[model samples]
Target: MFRLAALFLALSPATAFACGQPVCLVDPDSLSLTKIITFEGERAGAGPGHNIDDVLPLQGATFGEHFAGQSVGARGPHDEVSGDAFAPLTMMAGRAGQNLSLVHFSGNTVLNGYGSAGFPKRDAQGEGAIAVLFDQDQSALAFDLRGGEDGAALVHFYRRDGSFIGPVPVQPTGEFAVAFLRSDGHADIAGFVLTNTDPQGLALDSLRFGKPPDMS
Candidate 1:
């Protein structure tokens, strides 16, 4: 039960990713993100499983902030098991008697449906983006994301073992932010301010456990 704010960012390369911002760049010396993956949870042999789509957005774009004004039908937390892009089908076998199957659709509806959440209230749209970073023999990832307009933002963290660690803190900037964590346990976090003066504004925000660049 880790708690991060609604504006923090996340990085997950174990699965394919898409972003709404152009700031996320791959270091090239790391792995590559190939395809976008979708996951559905299993219930008592009925009911639809939780669905989650990953979105990476370019900087300076305002998305999903409108959803903040109202409750949405497609809002919820997702377990990595039910519909995670990085986990393989074989991992589902660990669960008791329940059988999990992967459904290959032409594309993910949840990830692509952010546009319909209503605007001002604008639909959340994004392009696929992936970047990789490494720490010696181990690997880590970085990404830029944008939830649909009004859609609250969140940052989730997990260890290399596929276990949940927690969420990070997010600034109350009213826009999205990107987070980068190195395998060595250091992070550099920042976000583009959602304003008119410097439409493409950027700030050298804070880190969880290490020194970050001066924001002044």
Candidate 2:
């Protein structure tokens, strides 16, 4: 019986798990979502600007664009961006809403195993972290991330009232990787913070939020 159990465990797919916490699935496509933010559209300035607060409260299936033309050094903090209240999806810098930058990538830039033109980068002060708030409460969340050459990052879950839940580490080979986290039980996932240690910088794109297929 012991050997049979061990064999079953070995044959099972690897997953990041913890007691009373969410599970990190290896594939983002495993979860079906109703909406996705691609971050592609118009901008206020010719180059990367600071304190981008114009685009928010996105309506319908409309896709939001990032600020363009700013130099890499001039990238500043981003204001809170969100979808409609019905299916609320908001993204900020820190838990307390600190400032972060939205970067425009040109040339050969790839994230989550695919080419990316622009996306939000981690805040330098926050130590490569971005906080996301889900007003509607979600059972699952997924996004594309690009860590430094070393490739290391984590997803910290939280409740609606700003209570800590648990964390899942994401270590993908190469520069681009995708991360997906789904609650083990109900739709209690209120928010999550993604952090990376890449000194070269961290990038995020293609954020998806919705109920998991397996959940009732």
Candidate 3:
């Protein structure tokens, strides 16, 4: 018997997800949702000129067989352009002696990884990508987002049981926010967001989610 845990961290301008592998869910419209696990908030201009940044958890989901899906995000063709988004929503198997490596996303552009060491607009050809990586034993998870100034980037941590640990802070903090996980032992989900609205900084508002209950 497999277990499923679905979580979505979202904003009016951002959205995200996470899962085990094989199966997954989607909630692209999170700005106008109303529910107990969901709330509303906004930022001046921290998103991609229009979209917000979000994280999610796909339950009972598999990538192949042996390994479960840990994280997902957009990959880029260059370190400047945004790539298509993907995540591990179900459980997938890994090679006999190998682990799941190299999460990928593509579309108009192709991207592999993400970082804040340098600006994609002024540095590398292909921009970096955001991702959630599950540890080897699948006991814990980590979030990584790049493109901010200085070393003050964005990161997060969580327990396999779907408990919130808190946001990971970087130096010289730029803009940032936080979201929570919503699960019901099913294979669907909705996003919840808490944003920061400080000038050239991060602001967090109330918690929010979607309507009609999507998780199964």
lDDT of 2 at 154: 66
Query: Rank order by lDDT, top first?
Result: 2, 3, 1
Q: Cα deviation of 129 in candidate 1 (Å)? A: 14
Give the alpha carbon lDDT tens digit for every residue of 1-216 in model 3. 111212233321122224332112233232233432111121212222212122222231111211132332222222121221124322222222111112222111111122222222222211332333232212111112222343333333333443333343345543232233323223133111111111122222222333334556
Can you write out model 2's per-residue Cα lDDT over 1-216, one digit (the tens) per residue? 775565334223343343234555545544456776655552322123232322233332221221121111122332222222222333432222133334445422222110121222234422334556554677666666644556456666656555556777766423454645553545667766555544444566667776424433
Instruction: Give the alpha-carbon lDDT of every model.
Output: 0.23, 0.44, 0.25
Residue 115 deviation, candidate 3, in Å? 10
User: Candidate 2, overall lDDT?
Assistant: 0.44
What TM-scores do the predictions have? 0.25, 0.56, 0.22
Which of the predicted structures, 2 or 3, would earn the higher TM-score when compared with the native? 2
For all predictions, the C-alpha RMSD in Å is 17.0, 10.0, 16.8
TM-score of 3: 0.22
Query: In candidate 3, which residue ranges exceed 4 Å CA deviation?
Result: 1-129, 135-151, 173-216
